[model samples]
Target: MSVWLENAIARANSTSDWLSPIRSVSLAALKDTPWPTRKTEAWRYTSLKSLERATLSPSPSVNQDTPEQIDGFESFNLVFRNGEFDLDSLTQPLPAGLMISYLPTASEEMKQASLDEFSQIKPGRHLFGLINDVLAQHVVRIEVAEGVSISQAIRITSLIGLNSESHTRVFVKLNKGASLTVSEHYQGNVESLNTGFVEYDICAEAKLEHYRFALQTDKAISLGGCHFKLGERADLNSTLVGFGSDLSRVDTDIIYDGEFATAKLNAFYLLDGKELFDLHATVEHAVPNCTTLENVRGIVADRAKAVFNGRIHIHRHAQKTLAELNNRNLLLSDKAEINTKPELEIYADDVRCAHGATVAEIDKHALYYLESRGISRSKAQVMLNFGFINELIDQMPNQVLAEWIRPQIRNRFAEMEVTR
Candidate 1:
């Protein structure tokens, strides 16, 4: 084991009313999980050597600035800074039949309930997920009672204020027949690195729509994992959009536990100016008649690098399962890099599964045609790149968020300073 892993294990085993089990599990997994190195197939393009060299410590105290509100959405907002929840900044009330509270401040019943499910889903499979489980301090807990449907969106924002390391854990549960929408917005100044973990549970017939926007400054590093479970006939839709960060990785894991479940996962990433971004996703179908679809698109420019790994698994009993995975990337500069993999593992004979991956640069013929028609080369390139990701962005149900993200996509091309 590396010296850093030893220290992490030692620190995690220290005193705390909570996190003891997490520490034990994390420490046990340290010896088994593979280190993310150049030789690792899944991590071939993303090297963890830099993280291995840096000494990581708990973040320092931080006072957050006032949060900026978005129009047209009356949301219940929860704010966190440096891994600590700021109760005073919360503006909206918890919906009827729903409860939202910080884990450190939750009641004994809530704490016990959370602990019961903390390690229920395996986090050791992913190195970053294990690291987050062992190191996260504050946790946001949300519970939706049976038969409740919340119309308002619940927004959670994690902002880093200084040059330090921080971690966050979030747990969400939806009872049978419950429906809700949750949005996580991660933004920070160019000061520090941030890491986080979020887990979700959906009961029978429940529905959940989750959207995440990660926009950090150029000097920041962010790593996160989303683990989820779907019950019988449950429905889940998730969209992830990332634009700004020096280095970022987002991993998602979804499992179907009951029959007739459906899930959709869509993601878009834009990187420029030496930024490195990665997305790893897995969908497992354990029951019959379950369906899953995954689509991810990325644009890289000016030495930026992007990686996408997508996998779909169908168990022996998962008959009649249908799954599709697709990953596509567009490179605007010769120096830009992209690595994509789409994998499918199936044990059931009556299942339908397909995967496709593509990596290419801008089409010179299309650009030349547009430029000949009195359009600037830069604008034509931007238009083509935007069109590449627009296919997925159009799937977003919230118009407000879709419009909000369009400008960021345009701004990324503008920052590249590419001209005809």
Candidate 2:
């Protein structure tokens, strides 16, 4: 372990409420697992120099009077400032069948029960996850009882301010036949380090639609991941929109624990300048008749770089499984770079799975066709580029979400020059 991490852990031990066994487990894992480098397949195209060279510490407390709201959307909001939950900003009187509690305030019994549930989740050999276990300050828990459906969305926003580091954990549980829509937003105004981990356990026949927005400044460094386990016939729809950062990585893992589970993932990224964005996702089919579909699209401009890896695994007992993965990218400048890999592993002979990837630039003929109609070259190029991602944006679950995302993309295009 690095001296920096050792000191951080020592400081965390003085105040941590986690049981001794959990702390020991994290420390041992940190000692045995080496930090990732370019040689690591999962991190081959990404560099860790920026994160390792900086001094990272926990963020200070924040007091915000009012939570940020989405215009025209009647939603429940939870705000986290500088890695700590700002209870003062939350709306009172939570919806029926829903409970929202902070770990630091919960009783000992509640903390222990949450620890038990958290211990069952496997972070797939990520060192950052172990680090989070050691230093996370606040754990947010949300539970939805059986047969409950929330009509309004639940919005959770993470705002990082100044030079600080934060590790946050979230736990979500949905009982049988329950349904919920959750939107998570992450933003930072200054140079900072942020680590976020979320685990979702969905019971039989539950439905969850999760939307994530990573719109951080160019000075931020962010690492975030999500793990999901679905029970019998459950349905999950995950959608993500990411703008570039100095260094950012997002990981997603989904597994089926019962028969006939289904998961669909859709993602779009807009990268420019010298920003880097890395997205790694894996979907596992452990039971029969499960289906998984993943689609990712990206636009790279200037000297920005992006990495995408999508994997689908079908276990031997997972008969009659159907899965597909696709990644498509557009490069707007000669200096831009994109690395994409789509993979499939099927041990079941009865399963059908496929994976494909493509990277290309704007078509000159299309630009010329529009130019022949008396449109300016720059305007025509912007129109063509916008059309590339229009289909994906149209598939958003709600108009409010789409309205929230489109302006960012349009403003980005208006400020930059497009090249063939």
Cα deviation of 400, candidate 2, in Å? 1.1
**Residue-level lDDT tens digits of model 2 in 122-220:** 464776778877777778988889999988787888888767787778888989999988888888846788888888898899999898887775878
lDDT (0 to 1) per candidate: 0.81, 0.82
Regions of candidate 1 where Cα sits further than 4 Å from its true position: 1-4, 31-34, 53-57, 89-91, 189-191, 417-420
In candidate 1, what are the lDDT values of residues 1-420, reduced to their tens digit? 566667766777774767676667676786688667777887788866545565455747665565566777667888877777887744455668888877777788877878888856544678877877787778788889999998887888887766667778888899999998889888875656677777889999999999988777577778887788999999999999977466788888999988999999999888888888889898888899999988888888888888888989888999999999988888778888888888899999998888998888878898899999999877888888878888888899887878877887887876764422
* Candidate 2 deviant stretches above 4 angstroms: 1-3, 61-68, 89-91
TM-score leader: 2
Judge candidate 1 at residue 242 and give its lDDT. Answer: 79
TM-score to true structure, per model? 0.94, 0.95
lDDT for model 2 comes to: 0.82
